[model samples]
Target: MDGSSTTTALVKAARAGDGDAMDRLYRRFAPVVHGILLSRVQAADADDLTQDVFETALQRLHELREDAAFPGWISRIARRAALDAWRRRAPFTGEIPEAASPADSVESHRDAEQALAAIRSLPEAYRETLVLRLVEGLTGPEIAERTGLTPGSVRVNLHRGMAQLRERLGLREHER
Candidate 1:
């Protein structure tokens, strides 16, 4: 009748080894995972890693703590896989070189290495949440749903992550 129930039924079917159920589950959640990878990884690599996340989720679904918790469980795996991808991008860490930029203009020459360096410097938990929202472009609720955390936990991570990002960027927090 409703999407929630439909999702539950689909997950149940998938858990039972139904090929169609697995297909339906993939159709429902693939875009969300793809979008997250697209935001957090290079476009060239996102598609491949997105596939990996789903494959990992499918294999690990039986380990999920709850049926309704599928989104969060898969999200956490995606986050970990994305983080590993980030770490593997370069041999050393410093300012993301200008080469990673798409253009050569002085202004357009934003350094990806630098930005990622900043993001990586954050506490692990906060960094993951920030990337999901800012880089992955997932909403707080979407993140909560995927990560198996509460909406409030996602919000707290966002708030704290922003504060940390601001500090890392050398800006003083503005008191409103």
Candidate 2:
């Protein structure tokens, strides 16, 4: 069967309590979810939240109204999980990661700072779409499938986000 058909079968079986199908689903979507979480969350937190997302999807799979849209349902769950992780995080202004080398870390540190600042500055829709596209490496259709966005919406978000990123970086041209 083709990939789409395989995914449909997996979703149906997973909803029917097939452990192997659930495992397949986990393998299929975990990277997409993890990529979305990595930008706004710490890697460790992203890992934990990824598990929570899949577990939640598995437990609630029976409630899914459309098996063909399982990826979008799971994406919504992952986004919510990441946002929750951010809300629970303590406010801090210093470097997010511990630094061992002061002189050697300047460039790397600045890059991180710039990325975080750019992400925070974008509108909510733009930010999520950017992270999913840029960091998660998801295609427009994949993101649309996962996030329940129309493909056109994804394109608009990506365009707006690239414009904002270019503005933030003082670049003459947009990049996505």
Q: Which candidate comes out best when scored by TM-score? A: 2
> lDDT of each model, Cα atoms only?
0.71, 0.77
Q: Give lDDT tens digits, candidate 1, residues 137-166.
A: 778876676556688988998899888887
Model 2 scores a TM of: 0.79
Model 1, clash count? Answer: 6
TM-score for each prediction? 0.67, 0.79
- How far off is residue 49 in model 1, in Å? 2.3
**Candidate 1 wrong stretches, greater than 4 Å:** 1-6, 16-47, 63-65, 79-106, 109-112, 173-176
Model 1, residue 15: distance off in Å is 3.4
Q: Estimate candidate 2's alpha-carbon lDDT, on a 0 to 1 scale.
A: 0.77
